[model samples]
Target: MAKQALGPIRRSFAPWDDPEAKPLIHFRGVTKRYGDFTAVDGIDLPIYEREFHALLGPSGCGKTTLMRMLAGFEEPTEGDVLLDGASLKGVPPYRRPVNMMFQSYALFPHMSVEKNVAFGLKQDGMAKSEIADRVAEMLTLVRLQDFAKRKPHQLSGGQRQRVALARSLAKKPRVLLLDEPLGALDKKLREATQFELTDLQVDLGMTFLIVTHDQEEAMTVADRIAVMDQGVIRQVATPAEIYEQPASRYVADFIGDINILEGRLEKGANGISRLVVPEDGLVVETDQPVESDAQNAWYAIRPEKLRVSLDQPADIAVNTVSGEIWDIAYLGDVSIYHVKLDNGTIMRATTANTTRLVERPISWDDRVWLTWDRNAGVVLTS
Candidate 1:
């Protein structure tokens, strides 16, 4: 059997928007401690049905530890975990209604793909006919039916990873836990498999909770992401929300490249943020409102938002800065200009390579003006 191309996705899923959506998995003040060290500290979160949630963070950030608690591999030291309204306390890993796929693929080199996929069903004491049928179904779902006879060594890295995925899905667990599932594949294959995984998850209507340190991977496939750090949950939101409206300075820096400038909020009209960076001689206006009591604010602007030109534009009231182009990075698809101001502050502006030929584009050591719209970036208090 082979996977048939699915029709266009009729509707997008957004369960978090519904007020009545109950959580399929809930972490109720969950905390895990090993000796004197605490890995997860009082985390309360929920995962709705059919939601592809991601636990994203850097290494040693306790993301894996939190996922392990849900997998029943580790028990919480303080709070409890619930799966579909039932407490998962003291439940063994094998008995839980969950399955985990490891990062290494963990395929048996000697076994064929069919046998590897059927291994889990066989372990559950399923009849031979049922095991075969389940294995076939899983192979078809993962688009690996033709490679069922091949051993792990004979298959490509992507194929072997699919075999592991097929085996994991053979059991039809309510929730699938993936621990860095695509860590081994090369970049191209990894990106390809990400879409495949998303489509398959939608096709099967499975709730997948993945743990990964890669920011792009988490953002690409997940409906919502939980960004964790130092045994604490920092921000949990949709990919676009997290990227465009990061909660803190740590989150903004962690997710992508950002240029932060020290600024103070000045009194302005309603719904307008007036920022004065005395150090850099910059007056910035942003769409987001600033409170009168708030102080010690910083302006976080992405490089792509800033437009650079050789001459000053007429619309300087929005936001503008004059500087000399210090450097340029031609990245084929985009060119980044590093502008150095008189106040010894360096800022970056990214311009896309839209034209086939560059006709008098700004170059290194050229006097340039940087401009951005008021709504291009939001004012960040933290």
Candidate 2:
């Protein structure tokens, strides 16, 4: 099959030099409503040009609704949606300088791949020669040149999806919107396509906006992610930033597996604050100072950060606890140990499975020690 053809490189309008310039796509208090229910509740965001931004959240989190509004399929009840500093209030989907790839791969079964791809251009009344050239280029770009004569039914699922992508890109829109683009593919194919899409985005240098509920997928592909919930954006940052330093307890728990320890703040003599987990009889020292009145707090620690051993390490400074192993799961790469602490609290720790044997250094029901550096745990106030 001929690979998809590359379109002419289009210069981006991103103003990296000017510090005061507005973003490429701006949502100024954008909101959408259906009767009493509000799908998007006054969201304000700025998407820079050439950014692979992902709208990540669970189903019914208003991500799809927000994307539809941006595509001009649904109008916002209030606020403005701006593209390239211009308002999108009166623009229709066909007239807008953007194209959307539907999650269903919405290709017509009766039409050949080439004809399907050329449908949009023909509707715009382009010359036959020009449409043929663009269609040929798009087929090659997507690696479907040989499949141009094949109908949608004769192609594989992945090929059909590529056809949809080619059709969407044939118009060369300013922005490309993908709605769960990889949702239909199998696990192995989805993983392969993720990188392929990322490479395509970088090569094309087009601003791409993807909506998905898969956290791992978003982390893998997006330059930055907007974690949304209940129609509100919880946090917006790079994947690493969002994972390492979440804004709140909800965010901390939602993004990944975290061990949260509830504790009370205690004032120390040196202006440093300590957390007292009375239940665990554990005292964790933190460099961050806390207010005297802030009694309730949580210490968030990733499972991998906790060090597990049969005996406590002498070099440990603070935040150490003794527990008995309750369960052990031997995943090929790592072993997940669930330990019941002396305080009756359960804590999870992951250890590397170095050898290929059934025997474990620490078996279930064995007493073990869990220790971590104070700095490794983040203090969550909210």
TM-score for each prediction?
0.94, 0.91
Per-residue lDDT tens digits of candidate 1, residues 302-322?
A: 899898888889877778888
Q: After superposition, how far is residue 29 of candidate 1 from its true place, in Å?
A: 1.3
Model 2 TM-score is 0.91
True-vs-predicted CA distance for residue 265, candidate 1, Å: 1.7
lDDT of 2 by residue, 1-382 (tens): 2234333322333343458866889888989999999899999988888888999999999999999999999999999999999999989998998899999989988999999999999989999999999999999888999999999999998998999999999988889999999899999999999988877887777889999999989988887889998888999888887898888888888888889988888777676678888765688877665666448998888898898989778876677788899999888899899999887889889877777877677898998989887667788888
Q: Each candidate: what lDDT? A: 0.86, 0.87
Colliding pairs, model 2? 3-140, 3-141, 3-143, 4-140, 4-141, 4-142, 4-143, 5-140, 5-141
**Top TM-score hit:** 1
lDDT of candidate 1 vs native? 0.86
